[model samples]
Target: MESSFSYKQTVPSEWVDYNGHMNDAEYNRAFSLATDAFIDHIGLDAKGREQYQYTIFTLETHTCYLKEMHEGKEFEVVARVFDYDAKRIHLFLTMYNADGEVVSTLEEMLMGMDQDEGRPAPFPDLVAEKVEAEYKVNAGEDTPKQVGRTIGIRRK
Candidate 1:
C-alpha cells in the first residue's frame, strides 16, 4: 500500500469531449498510468511479465468527475492501494490540477492473471506477501465508507 504515487501529464487535444473538457476515456488512461506506476513500485514491471507471465486485469471501475479539465492543461495523478486479497486488488486514484484541486476520482478492482493462459490466477507467494504488507500498513488509514464507495444510484 503505497501512501501515494505521482504522475505528470498534459491534457491531449484528442481527449477533449463535446462538453469541452477531458473526455471520460482520458480518465481511464490516467488511471491506467497510475496503476502501472504502483505495480512497478511493488516489483512488478514489463520485464517481470516476460519472466513470470503474470499481469493484472481490471474487473470493475467507478469514476467521479468533480471538476472540468481542458486540453493543454498540466495535471497530476496520485494513486493508493486500499485493499487486496490473494487474487484481487482494490485501488483509489485522484487526479488534480496545477492548483491542487481534485478534478476526478477513480476506484477500481483488479485481479491477477496468468498472461500465458489469459486466465485469473492466484498471486505468487512473494508478490502476495509484499501486497499484504502494504495492505496492513495502509488499512484503516481511511474510513470504510470512502474505501468501499461505489458511484451511481442505489436500487431499493
Candidate 2:
C-alpha cells in the first residue's frame, strides 16, 4: 500500500442538494481543496509560487461518486502521487468516511504553470525532486480500480 496524505473535512449543510446528499460540485470542491493541500505539502504553496513564479493548474479530472454523503458527515481524503514529470502530475484522491468506507474517488492530471507567462512550465529543480519522490513512493502499491476509468455505456 502507498503512503498517502490525509486531509480531513466536514460536510457542510450548504453543500446538500435537493435529494439531501452532498452536491456533485461539492465533491469536486473537496477534492480541489485536498489538491491544494497536496500542492502545499509538495512545496508549491503561496511562498513557492511567489519565489519561483510557479504553480499548478488542473488539466483534467475524473471523479467517481461511490456513496452518498449527507450534511454534517465527517470525511477524509487520502491522496497519492501516482506519477509526475517536469511539467505534469498525475494524482489519485479517495474520499472516505469516518469508518474508512470510500465515498468518492478522483483521478487528476495537473500541469505546472509559470505565472509570468501564464502558460505551462517545468517545475523548478527542488520542486521536481519532491514530486518525483512522492510518485516513487506511491507508484509501487496495488493499483486502485478507479484509475484510468473511462465514462461510457457498457453492454451487459
Best by lDDT: 2
Error of 1 at 118 (Å): 3.7
User: What tens-digit string does per-residue lDDT give for candidate 1 at 12-76?
Assistant: 99999999999988888888888888777665688766677898888888887888999999998
Give the whole-model CA lDDT for all candidates, comma-separated: 0.79, 0.91
Per-prediction TM-score to the true structure, in the order listed: 0.82, 0.94
Candidate 1 lDDT: 0.79
Q: Whose TM-score is greatest here?
A: 2
Residue 128 lDDT (model 2) = 93
For residue 6, give model 2's deviation from the true position in Å. 1.7
